[model samples]
Target chain A: MSPTPTTATPSDVTPARTGGGRTGGLRLTALHTRAQLLETVRVPIAVIGTVVFPTLTMLFFVVPQPFADDPAQATAATAQISLFAVMSVCLFTYGVGVAEDRALPWDSYLRTLPVGAGPRLAGRLLNGLAFALVSLVPLVVVAWLLTAAALPADRLVLTAGALAVAALPMLGLGLWIGYGMSTKAALAVAQVLLLPLAFGGGLFLPPQMFPGWLDAVSTWLPTRAGRDLVVSATTGADLPGTTWPVLAAWALLTAVLAVRAYRRDEGRRFR
Target chain B: MSAPLVRLAGATRRYGDVTALDGVTLDVPAGQLLGLLGPNGAGKSTLLQLVSGLRRPTSGVVELFGRPPWEPAARAGLGMTPQETGLPPTLRVREVVDVVAGHFPDPVPTAEVLERFGLGDLARRQTGGLSGGQKRRLAVALAFVGRPRLALLDEPTTGLDVDARHDLWDAVRAYHRDGGTVVLTSHYLEEVEALAERVVVVDRGRVLVDGSLEEVRSAVPARRVRVRAAALPDLGADRALVDGDRHELWTSDADALVRRLVGSGAPFADLEVASASLEEAFLAVTAAADDRSGSRSATGVPGTSTPTTSTPEVAR
Candidate 1:
């Protein structure tokens, strides 16, 4: 039998490629990203990790605590919410993302395609960033509109801006944990890391409410810096000048370690 | 003649202290269907991975059309269906093909690929829902979507039934007919015997035999000959596994001692010959090579050959 011929649909056929460029590589990266999106939508467990758990926490915070009579309630509340956002974006997203990556043969298969390492890395970063941003919306709005008061508009903008900048380092650091640790270890660490970082970073309470030493340490924590940036954003409180620098350093260090760890892990897993 | 599509020149890949592929070399030219047959840990998958550029060789080089194997341009003319199922389960059959097709500069239409593989109805079905044989066929279809110059297939027929296996064999034959080179690795001796014109037998990270199947068969001196005789005549020194009454005796060798049987006036009648099966020859060749390497332990690791020969494990 003669083989059946197939006609090209207009949408299916793009302009014929005449040049030898990195276009195929780019397309592979795009397909990977598309796959990531489809998986996020199709897998309910993924939805919970990315959206539901964080949203529930947002709702929890927006509800006023029973002990509103406490003298330092406002400062404590702001600190608590900041901690929640940071952990949600950094540890939760990154940790779960890593576990998800481990479950699939994405890294191995992608490495084989026309996709260069750079594009694959870029696609992942974009996905993580997108997920982090989506995670912020519910919590950010709930914390702002639902709460009686928040950092003033100008401070809120600055603090949000600062938090965004701070998030870059946390993202990189989270990648280090995700890439370096096995899936089981990552989950355990994420669980252990989540509670302390949240409580210590003062997402549920203000760091100032703690003793001087505790407060001093919290200042160095990424969550602490994120909280301070948020507090400064809303209340116009003066954050330490070193806050940005510290976050920047953390980001740089983590990025380097993360790249090394990911490359090493990929090399071993593929072999 | 066109240049060889894929070449492995002294290819070696090491995993820490262990060598996965040890100075292995082969050429897969156009219109050639080459099968890499070996027991488990024989470096068949490693060779396919090297050809696909999914992994690089530790020392020697793997080239496609004179370029390094990993180059996108080099891989453009190559198709690979890995030993493990690489297709995403949740994606529909069409979607899986489309995803792979997107990687190529010029990909065949998804519908055409689906129809060619008899997967037109399954196009809308998720890959996870397809049966194993269906999945394997889809994988083959996806590999052929770009009309690749060469194909690297690892255990391509792991779960197919007899009919499906024969259908896939036809597909492979058709692929070779289209001037494509195929490097297939399978545990199934019959699959390799039927599909491959050339066989490359590997054991313990080394190539034991690389030539036409007939030549590999001839390497081991074993062929079954059936003859009718009223009385048995064993004149020569060759060992014989004979059965049946004096009216007939079956010998594994016909050329050497069977002549003596007729010379002795034995009632040698109704003579028939059975060629030594490729499977038996493969095992014998592998056994001899292992013994030469002193790998009697059958752990399938090179340079660690033991003194007491162990049976070679079948490739999974």
Candidate 2:
């Protein structure tokens, strides 16, 4: 027979006195974030893909060119790639990850639990930020080794702060796509949208080389606005007058759409 | 006395044009092992979802521990295994158990849970690499990790082998012995027979019968008659289910039918009569309920009648 002492009866496993208080909720959120990070890290290919794609693009396209020897041009290229890294994390983590989770039965089980959505949503946001940060490491290393990209110590910190703020619209857009479509559809859409946004925002080539019509439109895009902000911080370039308003507008719109998509999905599936 | 662990009063859930659960009322007392038996689209999953607060009803009320089931506090002592669950593929079995167990205040240890479910060896393996049967076992085991007072299992052993099913049955019985309330659904009649103390038969979004297993069996008025004859005998039975040369009949009045059979002096060599099994009782209950609904629809009777009280029914 088992010799474990019976110190507590089944009834003693009653509801906790704290209920769903802030501390309990936060603790659960932390655990969820930790688990999600572990799952992502276990799949090394997923981590490598996000980091490698942008780093390779910088090596082949930016570092071998005459612009590699110019501090201002090299810094702009580095900033552009940094934005690319953040965008990739947002799209893959939010768009593909959310769609996949929705298709899972574990999602339904979690929805039924007493804990509110706060923990799970917060956990996902944290996971997205971690990947975004890791995604930048490769691009930074390549820039330092092969290109003349240089930033004052304070400007480097500023570039990071700007990068975080600039990633908001992309994260919102990812959430919108994730909640609005199935896994297969979300994956396709994320891929299809990635190239157009990257090219249109002058991420691969300098905005100075864009056609007149493209220059007019690219100035309004969230990606271009984000790039301009990052480039200005890192390269000491003058910030464009339209950059702040354009990025702010896109952030607001995407945030609204993301919230709407989430509510619509919840109403359709769980109500 | 305390309120029942789960209470649904006139709950109705509709999806656009489809009515998943129609004005249903039910009560599940503490420490009762209730089995839900029904074919597909019979509102079994919907009922469980409402009780677990995964889906809200369109009307009426669903309560857990005298509070709305949707309330976090009300679900603190509840555990559920849905019909289908896909565990996070990359996480190990042990990690999944630990993450879920962390949601509860006083959880059963992860190691003990894994051992009890025969998953001790697979604890370090990623869930995605596990076989279907192993995954199913893990899903069910997760329900007990929280040491919940009540567990709602929707088709818990649906995809398990016979041996696995029996092992799972023992685990369920052990949980019940420890004073846990359970409401489980299954399409397998044998599964219900083996474990259920109380059975509820649902059809077309309605509970056709609810009572002890014996009570449900007695509710059917038909008796099974088996006889051997050279050819088919005109025993004047209402319906016949035949196996080879033997004829099985369902008749309301078996004694009168048998008297006629003997008087006719037909070349019947062997005769046998026995009470109907639970399978037949289940079929009869569902059939009668279908007939009632069919006639009601034919008569153009609106389905918006007053909600019925939660009374155990011999027949719908």
Off by over 4 Å in 1: A1-26, A66-86, A89-93, A99-103, A149-160, A267-271, B221-281, B288-316
Tell me how large the interface RMSD of candidate 1 is: 7.1
Residue pairs in steric clash, candidate 2?
Answer: none
Q: What is the TM-score of each candidate against the true structure?
A: 0.79, 0.85
Span of 10 residues, lowest total lDDT, candidate 1 chain A: A1-10
Candidate 2 Cα errors over 4 Å, as ranges: A1-23, A267-271, B82-85, B220-316
Which whole-number lDDT from 0 to 100 does residue A14 have in model 2? 42
The digit string of per-residue lDDT tens for model 1 on B1-316 reads 5556678899988776677788888877666788888766777777777776767888987987666766655666667773335566677788778777777766788998888778999988988788888988987776677666667777778888988788778888887775667888877767877888888877667776777877654454445455655557554422233455423222235666667766787666677666545445445434544455432212222322333234233233
Judging by DockQ against the true structure, name the best candidate. Answer: 2
lDDT of 2 by residue, B25-111 (tens): 889887788998766666787888888887788998998877777776677778887433468889999999988887887778999
- Among these predicted structures, which one has the highest lDDT? 2
lDDT for model 1 comes to 0.64
Candidate 2 global TM-score: 0.85
DockQ of 1: 0.20
